[model samples]
Target chain A: MPVRLFLALLAMFVTGEAAGQVRAIEVLGPRPFGYFIGDVIRLQVDVVLDEPFTLQAGSLPRPRPVTYWLDLKTVAVDDRGINGGLHRYRLALDYQIFYAPLEPRELAIPGFSVTATDGAHRVEANVPAWSFLMSPLREIMPRGTGDPVYLRNDTGPMILPVRRWLSLAIASGIASVLLLGLLAYNRAWWPFSTRRKRPFVQAVRAARRAFRSGSGAEAYRAGLLCLHRAFDATAGRAVLADDLSSFLKTAPAFRPLEPEIGRFFQASRRAFFGADARGAEADLPRTVLIDLGARLAEAERGLS
Target chain B: MVDLSSLFHHSGNRWAGVPLLSVERLKSILLVNTLVVAFAAFTVSGWLAFSAWNDNRVISGLATGRDIAVGDRARPEILLARGQFLMRRGRLDEAQALVPAVRISGDRRVLAAIQYDLANARLRTALRLIEDMKIDQAIPLINLAKDGYRAALSVRPDLWDARYNLDVAMRLVRDFPEIQPSSEEPPQETPEKLWTDLPGLPKGLP
Candidate 1:
């Protein structure tokens, strides 16, 4: 099949399977998803299990019908499925919760497991966890309405020139120093240099230049080279051909860039080695590299 | 060439338009607003999450059941129900066996109540065995009855029947009066002569 057609079909199939799975449990919840004290927020866990299950009450340290607090009721499960399979089961559990007192609390709808025999094997698949909120009953209500808001300052323009120039100047100065150091350290790093010089910014700038020049292959290579040098600098060690996984580990910030990094690496291998990695050509793009850089910058900011 | 000065003047006029909004000022305002909204949202969400948590807590006095089958979780309701069904069917021994393994505190009181009934049944059994002269078996069963009554009393202290049964057992165990030598009476002289004659007493005893 043609490459584009194949990808489209694969995507369709994955999504199709994802849609059919039933949501067996729901946190019907403290409706409005919020609660106040002295309010009974009715909650029901709608469970559609393959086997008959019981909705028996569990023990609590404090009993309900408490004199000064609202009561939490006990509901028990029926044993309709003492001996049944996942397919032969049809059960839904419903519960109501009351937030009588002003105490704020968290509650877990415990994991439920169903036992099934897939013809030749018996397996248990636990439904994922479910939980809900209990806000403290607010002590005070809102007072009188407030006035309309307005911006009062006219010095907005003054702050911009100082803030923007300072940040940009600092960034440029840092990039320049790093570029000069890399150039002086490794003259033999690459045979060709196209006025692209910073370790991180150079890679991004080179790719941008290549895209502007309408050379996709050059743009792609520049993206990879940028990543390679950044990886080396960040790792403080030589990144080997086979140490990409280790490189990601050495710099965990790049973990979010996995998809982009993997794509670039695949494109580089196929372009240089003359090997055909199916779908590489269709997947590689300049925008992806740019986005990867943006993500990296954001991650770096977070780290700082 | 003909319109150069006019074009330059128009460009200068355009550049002179009211200064564009400062990106820094807009960003700061946005950041502050976002932080305020997020903090409020986080507060509300945390409150909602806690409310949901409260709903899931198991409260006491509610009838709850669990299953512990071999290694299977003994479902309290199933086990308790089975015990009740068995008791109704007159399978007292089987029913009694089911009650002890139920561990859910929510079901403990109910289980204790059932245990009280089981104790009563066992007491009846022990009484029957004693009537039949099955002394060896009756003793063990009577001891079991006492234990069941104790368990019932522990859970339901207000249960008078369990207290009465315990009282019955205490009363049934006969207490012999402590015997002492008579304080006022004189010693018998003839008994000493008899003791000497019988050759057990010393010769000077009389």
Candidate 2:
């Protein structure tokens, strides 16, 4: 009868404990010893609860100076969701210890309670106090030293990396100048003004000016000579009437103008060599000669 | 009796029997496009070079211990330099004012350096006050210095100097819980009890 009563009481106690919503609380951290001044200690706390209950975020500890010698640097919480009918919450806490102990001393991080609620029911879970041993950073006493307390030197201001920007600027400036030079070359600007590539253009201008001067034989001869000069320049040498075929073969770009060129050469021979200037004028009018000059200029520039 | 006009017109499209844009017009179009690009490049290059030059000047001025005029829109590095200069000149308040500006800087190193320097300045001042037996006046400065060191260490944990200084400050004055006034007790004995509760000089120090 006495054994039966004892067993029944123990079962009641176990059932009462299990009836609470919070299931378990576990705290994990680094080794509890060998910490010195300015060392950070990280602790992780995990709380398990029934599926319906959720941890109250507001009840969690806010980062602050926990003690005079210890600073609670950061606190982070992660909800692991529900697994196997248990809801889990993980809390990460970072604390920096600032105690300069003369000898190894034990310190306690105070415990706090957190609440979990499922709208209608509220349950409390306790995080137990943690203790750690802090070691001294330096000797308790110095023996015959000139300087008893020596602090570390301060960090100086650092110079920004300006050389990289300077180099980039220099490279871009060089590229811009080179491009500008290219533009100048294409536009035939200063130092390239005399290197005009369009000789037929100059011939057209000269022939127009001579035709405007008068309709006399002298003016016609001048215009014809201008055209002859243009041909010589284009061929890079004196191109006589007989060299027409070779010039056409070497410069296929002017092959379309072969018939007109041949007519001009015939008219030139009649006037200068055959001494029939009037008949040559009839064969090739001034307007025709001028128009032919313009066409040659256009073809030379690849415009035709 | 060849019709010259017809012949010339035929020749216009007879070059390889395909009409194409004139070479001069193509060359001119290409030249204009290239010129615009080059101009843009030149403008960008000039701007970069000028800014770099200006920044270098400011850096050199700071290195030589010259007081540079800081603008509201000054760069982080410039603000840091100014803060360091003020701290070195014993203007702790002005240097402290620059903290919020430097705190927002993207460069963690610069932020840490400024905090460390400012903390050092405060600690040095507090030490002098302690030498003069003005312990009451020095407590706040030491506390502020400790806070500064902590902030610097948060950003750059490898800052050994800041850590060492913070430890030194801690030993000078240990932190304790703030006393909350109890309505049941008389306020007269509070000051005396607080003074007694304060820790005395550290142990093992002459």
Candidate 3:
């Protein structure tokens, strides 16, 4: 009685396990031969489900590279349209075999799980693993060749391509340095560096200091002397009223100051040697004379 | 093209030489200079950050292999590294197990994996020969490994590493057997291969 009960129980367990796999899964080749590195292979899968289950989205394995060499390139699933329970999935794989095998050898392709969706309960089925031969490029033992194939050696770590970035960084670094130099050269802001002072700039500063606090008439004389000294130093010759034309020829940088030079010469003639000193003050106001000196200094600084 | 020739004619270009605006505008220089510096920093720093991220991925991959997460999809880069590690430690079985996947993604890196496997394989044979006190038995194995390195070099000349290992191999089996090449008989065993990790054969054959 015990033996009969055990046999009955074993049969029931086996039947239950078989019944749970409501769908059938059949996996075809990774293609039998003539494969090498960087080649693509095709595999066909057939899944037949029972009456209650229907194939739908997410029912198949997600398309991804099964292994580094074997990539799942494309996945196309077809439903028989009439719902005859024959579901077909065609998988395309791109592979590259680095092994230069001396003889024809087999390589395995790992299989994955497929899920079939019902109203609430999901039935799962396993797609058995499959393999195929990878044919060698050359003979296992070449007859006469002195150079024969040997084992592949280890590889080094990957070195990042930093050439592009390094070049850009170097270029930008140079540009910034040049720009900084231009800024420093233009501005006399850093006083330690020696720079030639324009003659007109020096004269303008001297004139401003000459009239600080004194008799208006004496200050007037001092300012006139200051203007005469600037013109003589700039021309490298005494610049009398008659020599104004020659002065303009020698230093075209002061061409804009032609009118101002004429005025200063007239004021000089009246202030030092004229019978009436009052006329000198009226001809060139103290304020106008100082402003003329300032304008000339600005033009000098603008000189390239 | 404002016919700048006319401007040059004005008063021998002395007054005109002075740009209408004096004082180099420091604002523009500073702005442009700042922009250059920023761009430089962005490129260099970006690469550094990327390198760090790559290193992290490799670290995570090592952990994944150590855990022996069989079905877990380790990145190809990580798998290559782990395979190399196993080979170096003389765990040829574990190393060869990853060969199919590594070999499939063939490139120069594959040459590297091949190089590692060959060196380790030679080391295994050399150690075995030493244990048996048979120095002569190791010569062909070393020569075969050198030939493998040479074949790898022929595939890629840019591998200085392959060149170095080839040199190492050449030094190991210092002189070739002068008498063997003329003979018609091919060695019964093929040379060491980069792919399968076959067990070493018993000694006593030429």
Candidate 4:
């Protein structure tokens, strides 16, 4: 029995939502916008809400005593009850006034009231007076005026409305940069290393700096070996045993620095493996090792 | 297997109006075509009889003019040749003007045939005007073209070329830019609002 009652209440709510009836009315725009003498000006009134009510002017607060120059008429009324619930119906009323042939800046439209009813109960609602300007007509202007002027009470904006949406503009720019950065990182660098990983250039630079510090000669040699291993990972071949000539021939973008690679390898071989000690050149000193590393770094840039 | 039974069930509920549709649309088209073909055959026979009658009428007139009796086919052949030459040169108007003179005077049927020919020439002239985009000038010319085709149809209802030309002329005239009366008032939103409001009204008889 309770479920049945609930279902009946739901059905009633649905039916009530589908029915559109006028209740309160509001004047949306400026009380006074603009008007010319002898010309008819149309003022707009928008119905705020409409449901379980109907409006009649006879039950208003001031019953027909006031007289105004402006003529009011219902222009359009829409009673649509789909999707929007009780707020679907909208009533548009027009207030028209003919020019008084006077150049006065201000004119008043009288207020009126309406009766609201929901069959059993009755209520009276009042609408306030609206004002309008009676201004002189402007002289004929050239085809292209420099810019259009906007009045304080005008519906249109003084400047483009989109100019105030700066946050949206900044957000769009940041999104674009993020999208491009993602594409570039994926295309150029992300596949090779993560944060914990070291790049081939960084490893090579570390070896060169260690050699310059004079104490870590063995560490510098190990660094060079590690860098060579990283380079091999990119080339898909071992580079420690391979001749520089053969490597340069395969990767021709590095062909211009073939002589530098040859010199560095020759000096390293004489210092570490050769039987005849060419004294100063024979001993792998820190300064000589640093210079050789710098030369190798330059060669790597050319290959890249 | 499921699809086969579904298809059979679907076939059972097929539209019942198919028979009426075929007979009303297809049969009418066939009937019209048969009637047009019969009329064309009749017009061909009429044309042959008219040509022979016209020859006899001219020979009789010539016998009266010369005051001597002679059966000569050379003169008629020479006139037909001249008319064909003028028509081939696009001088349809000049050629049509000569057809009446050769038809022999006081022959009512021949005079009607000549009128039909003149009408055809006027229709051709109107078509040329339309091709030039002279719409204002083409309006009168198109009417004359329709009149000429109508006259030919009155005498020879099976002339397909005349019918086709008349149809084309009518279409071209209708395609011309139409002048509309301008409203004095500026564009207002009230009428559109009224139209939009109409859709929300109750749909039943009330």
- Find the candidate with the highest DockQ and give its number: 2
| Residue range B10-103, candidate 3, lDDT tens digits | 7676775676642335565665668667666766755665664675456455544453333224444555566655655667567657656655
Question: What's the candidate order when arranged by decreasing TM-score?
Answer: 2, 3, 4, 1
Query: B1-206, model 2: which lDDT tens digit per residue?
Result: 76799888878758867757878689878867776776676576667667756876786687679988786467677877788778878988997888787776577887888888888888788777865767777778988998888888877877878877777776666555545666555323232332342232332334
Where model 3 places Cα greater than 4 Å from the true spot, the runs are A1-33, A37-113, A121-133, A143-149, A152-170, A186-304, B1-206
Per-candidate TM equals 0.21, 0.61, 0.36, 0.25
lDDT of 2 by residue, A95-184 (tens): 887777768999877778899999998899999988999887665443455533345666765665656656666665676677667767
User: Which candidate ranks first by lDDT, i.e. highest?
Assistant: 2
Displacement of residue A148 (Cα, Å) in model 4 is 31
Winning candidate number (TM-score): 2
Clashing residue pairs in candidate 2 are none
What's model 1's lDDT at B196? 29
Between candidates 2 and 3, the lDDT winner: 2
In candidate 4, stretches whose alpha carbon ends up further than 4 angstroms from where it belongs are A1-110, A116-120, A126-222, A230-236, A241-290, A300-304, B1-206
Worst 10 residues of 4 chain B by lDDT: B197-206
lDDT tens per residue, model 4, A156-222: 1011123323444444445555554544444354642332222355656666665455544364455
Expressed as tens digits, the lDDT of each residue in B1-206 for candidate 1 is 49799999999999898687776467656555554554555455555455433322211111232222222144444455555555545678887776656644456656666676666666666555644656556555655766666666555555555555543432222112223456555433243332222221122323
Worst 10 residues of 2 chain B by lDDT: B194-203
